[model samples]
Target: MSEAYTGGCACGAIRYEKAGAPIAALHCQCRQCQQRSGTGHASYVVLDRRDDLIVRGELQTWPVAGDSGNVKHNAFCPICGSSVFVTFEAMPEMIAIHVGSLDDPSCFHPGMVTYAARAQQWDRVGPGLKSFAEMPPG
Candidate 1:
């Protein structure tokens, strides 16, 4: 077991803890991610076990229609409007947390880049990382 991970919204209205380490960490450059993050991409860490997550405080979610036609619930703090975590209709067993929401974000090391096809040339991810134009095949 890895060290516990903890973080919350910018205003501290929402808090979360994951009992174990992340299974995967990556940056997504999909259109929806860019729009939601108001940037070129969104960084996320996936926790395979939903039970390891403990979220305290109310979260407001807006369902996003993915390019694949799957629905992803973008969870955020309603008060401070901070994007936090997300749940996907395509993968119900996992939770994707926004790496920016981490108390110590420097601890995150993204190993993959997704949706490279939509990435902006000005916002290119660093080289040598595993990358895919879209979600990798299962």
Candidate 2:
């Protein structure tokens, strides 16, 4: 078995352990991501199977419509107000955790940049990554 991925909120109010490897890691520059992260972009490590992730502690969640018109449920730590994870209404099996919430953020190796058209010039990622003007086709 692969080593588990462990992490939590800034104040340790919420914690999680993923038994499987991440399906993908990427940076999103959509307006919602920018606003939620209080930055030009937000980084996430996505897991294909929600069952692989075990989360503890109460998380506050809010629903927001994505550019695709699908509702995304954003989960955060109420104690520290740290954005922790997101679950999509359109893709219930998937779970995305913020890279900043990881115990070892170095494990994140972003493969792509989404919503590049909305990306701010000041928040540029490495030039070598694949970038899409919008979400890539699945």
Candidate 3:
């Protein structure tokens, strides 16, 4: 990607810029992702370098245990309750940004679907992508 990826929260209380292409992009259908997104799945872009992400404005955060039993930090806009990103305790160098929060969401292209076992039958993922019943192997 030539330009930096930029995005913000619904109420504009939080904004960010990521300076590199995503390392991986996928749709997570895990129960927690579903609950947070209020949808069947949550789409995200994984940035290889956490330091490449620059944020402005205060954000509220919540800690939750992931399926792997690792702590994950969910960050959101306190004003709009918009979930922005997540950081994993097991992978501190990576940052996952919610695709929907992107200024140009169309720039995102999910290459895979994860947590397929928990996915609702009515909320199927797109065709022609790699899928895993649970988390993909590293």
What is the Å distance of residue 19 in model 2 from its true position?
A: 1.8
TM-score, prediction 3 = 0.96
Off by over 4 Å in 1: none
lDDT of each: 0.89, 0.90, 0.91
Q: What is the lDDT of residue 94 in candidate 2?
A: 91
C-alpha TM-scores of all predictions: 0.94, 0.95, 0.96
Candidate 1 residue lDDT tens string, 6-114? 8989999999998667878899999888988999999998887777688999999999788888999999999999999999888888898898999989878899999
Q: What lDDT score is found at residue 88 in candidate 1?
A: 88
Q: List clash counts for every candidate, in order.
A: 0, 0, 0
Estimate candidate 1's alpha-carbon lDDT, on a 0 to 1 scale. Answer: 0.89
- Evaluation by TM-score, superior candidate among 1 and 3: 3
Clashing pairs in 3: none
Backbone clashes (count) for model 1: 0
Please tell me which model should have the higher TM-score, number 1 or number 2: 2
Ranking by lDDT: 3, 2, 1
Per-residue error for 27 in candidate 2, Å, reads 0.6
Point out the higher-scoring one by lDDT: 1 or 3: 3
